[model samples]
Target: MNRITTLLILALLVFSCSDSKGNNDTNEKLNALRVELDSLKKSKAEASNASNKQIATFLTFQENNAEEAMNFYVGLFENSRIIDVQRYGKDGPAKEGTIMVATFELNGSKFMCSDSYIKHEWAFTPGVSNMVECKTNDEIEMLFTKLSENGKALMPLDNYGWSTKFAFIEDQFGVSWQLNLK
Candidate 1:
């Protein structure tokens, strides 16, 4: 009876040793799954970064004012120019010679503007404004004065706690501006 029990114990030990080696195979599969998951995450991040490159700001203006607004903006910025302008034809919804769509650059930043023939109830509000950073006090002053012409100044140029000079103004075309000196 003792010899039979010893043989059974040896058989169980050999089976357990083989199962431990099987566990190493399971561990290898788990490590491979983890590596695959990491690679998928990296691929997703690269795709997101690529899609973020296509971004621009769009602005809408009243009838016949899109070109005027674009010209005004380009004139204000030193490194600015009108990229393109599309006008309405004689048989169009908008009046002939009026701007249909326009593209302009302001200080090297591109912006799209369009004139809507149909009137909209919504107008430019102070909630969304163009914030400009100026290098000198004179730059802020010049921009504030020009932007405030024929328009109201929401916040006068002054030294706020966070900046040396800051001013909020609504331009002649009702576009809000925040000129900051940095």
Candidate 2:
């Protein structure tokens, strides 16, 4: 081998080593960037969880006789109260001084209801109704027959294949009800 050839070979090896080192530095920087992005996503998720721990669902009912229905309902439940009461007279088609919305709690379940119209033959249809869940079949049958006492049954109390027991009815006051037992 000649002297020039040896010098050229050494210079090429040095240049290649420098380039590999640069590449390793670049790869390390890229890896750090990726880690930072993942940490940001995790931080965002944790912040959202800290802000709200649970999600709540609320149901609103429109009754023909809010005042009468609310009063009747208040007496039926143990812990029930008319949280907010409003009366509309000469303003809308609501019974003057009647309940606008009877927001109350029944067995710790929050509910809001209002009478949309003052005098109308309209009644609560099965299209919209409150469903009560029973832990046992006996409770289901008891509630079903009791609610059916002065009400009409849309579906008879029986062993519906879908659920262990179930029933549907509209109470005497025209309020629809549903009992589900599984």
Candidate 3:
């Protein structure tokens, strides 16, 4: 029924039916079994890879504080951790010790953030924001309080027609977030 059992049965059948002396029929059967085993292994590998793959969101900042933002955001979520970061070298293009690129996982979701060497006129806008679906009131409240610190609250955390508690905030780093109790 299971993969291990099926493989064991196939192995038994292959080895038991094979002869000590090499024969054309036995060689053909062995080759067939080997092919089937290889196919099964490949199929298992593909399935595992598909399930483990994750989609990531990328954010960039012109203020050269990507590391700070990544630390702040990752600290707010549960079961979160910083993965890896690449820093700019002592070059003229980007300042040394600044983040060139950084990757982190917040609540199991992957995120990529970077500091831009060139400044852009356009910064973060309310047109796009990260939406967080929280399970408890405390979660929504904490997220709203932390993310709105030194930033503007687009919508105060309150009851709405759709959710009991909801808030839209632009974080100190100019990233917007919409927190809702689900």
Identify the leading candidate in terms of lDDT: 3
lDDT of 2 at 32: 60
lDDT of 2 by residue, 33-140 (tens): 556556666767755643464432233335556666666666655556566676767776765775666566555455666766644565567888778878777777
lDDT of 3 by residue, 69-143 (tens): 999998899978887899989874799988888878888677899899989888888889899999999899899
RMSD of 3: 8.7
Worst 10 residues of 3 by lDDT: 46-55
Provide the clashing-pair count of each candidate structure.
Answer: 0, 0, 0
Q: TM-score of predicted model 2?
A: 0.52
- Return the TM-score for each candidate structure: 0.69, 0.52, 0.71
> Candidate 1's residue-wise lDDT over 1-182, tens digit each?
44435545554554455555567665565556556556666767755654564655678887568888888889898888787888889999988988888877688666888889989999888899998999887888899989999998999999878887899999999899999998
Indicate whether candidate 1 or candidate 2 has the larger lDDT: 1
The RMSD of every model to the true structure, in order and in angstroms, is 16.9, 18.1, 8.7
Better of 2 and 3 by TM-score: 3
Candidate 1 off by > 4 Å: 1-53
Q: Per-model C-alpha lDDT, please? A: 0.79, 0.64, 0.85
